[model samples]
Target chain A: MIPVIEVKDVVTHYGSRKILNHVNVDIQPGEIMVVMGGSGSGKSTLLRHLIGLERVSAGSIRLLDQDIGHMSHHELTRFYRKLGVAFQGGALFSSMTVGENIMLPLREHTNLDEKTMAIMVRMKLEVVNLAGFEHLMPSELSGGMLKRAAFARAVIMDPALLFCDEPSAGLDPVVSSSLDELILQLRDALNMTIVVVTHELDSAFRIADRITVLDKGEVLTIGSVDQVRASTHTRIQDLLNRRFEETILDPDEYLARLTGESI
Target chain B: MEHSVHVQPNGHIVSFSGEIDLENSPAARTRLLEVVEYATTVFVDLTAVTYMDSSGIASLVEAYQRAKKTNVAFVLISTSPAVLRVLQMARLDKVFTIHETLEHAQHAKH
Candidate 1:
C-alpha cells in the first residue's frame, strides 16, 4: 500500500542555520504517527513542512501522492480541503461561536446546504463530547473545552489526513488522556492518517502507532514505543528519562558570541 | 454517486452506488426526502455504495426523521461495510432500521 504522506530526504534552514537535516518519514494510511522531540529539535519545523506552512530548502514532501512544494497557490488552497490541522494553541476565532468556527471550513470550501453543514458541525461536536456547547464563544470555554472545540473544528470536514500539534499540551492529566482517546477514536472511526507533533511522552505513548524521535534537526530513531524505550542511544534515553544534558561550548565560538562577532 | 429508484409493490426502493460525499450528498438528500415525503414506505439499498461520508449519513438521518413524523416506514437494506463502520462509530446503527436482505426488510414492520 502507498503511504499517505512521504517526506524524502527533506532539508530545511532558517537563514544560515540548519533546522532539519535530511529528514525522511513515511506515514501509512489509518495510522497515528507521533513526532516527538525537545525544544529546537526541528519536530515543529517538520510539521510546518508537512502541512505546507513553509517550503523545505531541499528534497520533497508528498502528501496524499502530491508534491506540495511544486503546487501553485490556487492549487494548494484547493488541496488543503483534504487536510485538517489543529494548532497547538487552540486557534479558534474569538469573534465567532464554537459552531461557527467549526463550520468556517465548510463555508469556505464546499457548496453543501446550510442544514447539512449545521448537522456536520453538531456531529463533530458530539464526537468530541462537546455537544450543546456550540453557541458558546471561544473565551467562554475552559482550556480543555477549547482544545476539544479545536479538534471538532479540525475534523468538521472529515479530512483524509489530520495533523495535531501539541494536542495534549497545557492540560491536566485526565484531560490530556481524554484527548489521546479522542485521537484514537477519530482515527478508528474516520480512517484518517494522523501525524501528531508533541513532546508529552505519556500522550505520545498512548496514541502513537509509531514514534519518530528528533534531536538537533535530525531523526534520531523511529520505532514502536517498546523499541524506542529499549534503544541505547544516549540522546533518546535522555529524552525518555527526562535527563538534562549539560552543554559545553567551544572557547573560540563562546568568545565570538560574547563579543557579538561572527565566527 | 449514481442513484436510481425502483417502484415495487411494497414501496419505492432507492439504490445508490459509487461515493456519496460532500459534492453529491445534497442531491442524495433531496431525492431521499422527496421519496419519503410521499411514499408510505421506502427501502434504501446501499449494497453497492462503496463510500459515504458524514454528509451522506446526515442525509439518511434527516430522511429517517421525516419518515418518522410522516408515519412512513424507512428501512436500510444491505449497508456496505464501509458505510456500516461509520454508522456504527456514531452509534447510529442502533437508531436506523437495517436488514441484511431485501426479503427481510420487506417482511419487517416499523
Candidate 2:
C-alpha cells in the first residue's frame, strides 16, 4: 500500500542555521507515527514542513501522494481540506464559541447544510469529551479543555491525515493520558494516518505505532516502541532516560563569541 | 456512492453502496429525509457501504431525528464493519435501531 505521507531527504534551514538535515520518514495509512526529540531537534520544524507551513530548502515532502512543495497556492488550499493540524497551544479563536471554532473548517471547505455542520461539530466535541462545552468561549475553558476543543476543531471534517504538535504538553498526567487515548481512538475510528510531534515519552509510547527519534535535525532511528526502548544508542538512551546532553563548544568558536571577533 | 430505494410492504429500504462522505452525504441526507417524510418506516441498508465519514453519520442522525419527530420508524439494516466502527466510536450504536439483515428488521418492531 502507498504511504499516506512521505518525507524524502528533506532539509530545512532558518537563515544560515540548519534545522533539519536530510530528514526522511514515511507514514502509512491508519498508523500513528510519533516524532519525538529534544528542544531544537527539528521535530517541530518537520511537523511544519509536513503540513506545508515551512518551505523545505531541499528534497520534497509529499502528503497523500501530492508534492506539497510544488503545489500552487490554490492547489495547496484545496489539499489542506484533507489534512488536520492541532497546534501545541490550542489555537482556538477566542472570539468564536467552541462549536463555531470547530465548524469553521466545514464552513470554509464545503457546502454542506447548516444542520449537518452543527451535528458534525457536536459529534466531534462528543468524541473529544467536550460535548457540552461548545457554547463556551475559549477563555472559559481550562487548558486541557482548550486542547480537547482544538482537537475537536482539527477533526471536525474527518481529515484523512492528522498532524498534532505537542498534543499532551503542559497538561497533568491524567489529562495527557486521556488525550493519548483520544488520538488512538481517532486513528482506529477514522482510519487516519497520524503524525504526532511530542517530547513527552509516555504519551509517545502510548499512542505510537512507530516512533521516529530525532537528534540534531536528523533521524536517529525509526522503530516500534520495544525496539526504541531496547536500543543502546547514546543519544536515544539519553532521551529515553531523561538525561540532558552537555553542549561541547569548540575552543576557537568559544573565544570568538567571548571576544566578539571572528576566529 | 450509489443508492437505490426499494418500497417494501412494511417500509422503504434505502440501500447505499461505496463511500458516503462529505462529497455526497448531502444527497444522502436529502434522500433519506424525503423518504422519511412519506414512508411509515425507513430502512437504511449499509451492507455494501465501504466507508462513511462524520457527515454521512450526521445525515443518519438528522434522518433519525426527523423520523422520531414524525413518528415514523427509522431502522439501519446490515451495517458494514467500517460504518459500525464509526457508530461505535461515538457510542451511537446504541442510539440507532440496527439489525443484521432485512428479515430481522422486518420481524422486529422498533
Query: Highest TM-score: which candidate?
Result: 2
Where model 1 places Cα greater than 4 Å from the true spot, the runs are A243-263
Which consecutive 10 residues in model 1 chain B have the weakest lDDT in total?
A: B77-86
TM for candidate 2 is 0.94
Q: What is the TM-score of chain B in candidate 1?
A: 0.96
How well is each residue in A165-221 modelled by candidate 2, as lDDT tens digits? 999887766889999999999998888989999998989899999999999999999
lDDT of 1 by residue, A28-101 (tens): 99999999999999999999998899999998999999999999999999999899999998999999999999
Lowest lDDT 10-mer window, candidate 1 chain A? Answer: A243-252
Q: Candidate 1 versus the native: TM-score? A: 0.93
DockQ (CA atoms), all models: 0.53, 0.70
Model 2: per-residue Cα lDDT at residue A19: 95
Clashes of 1: 0
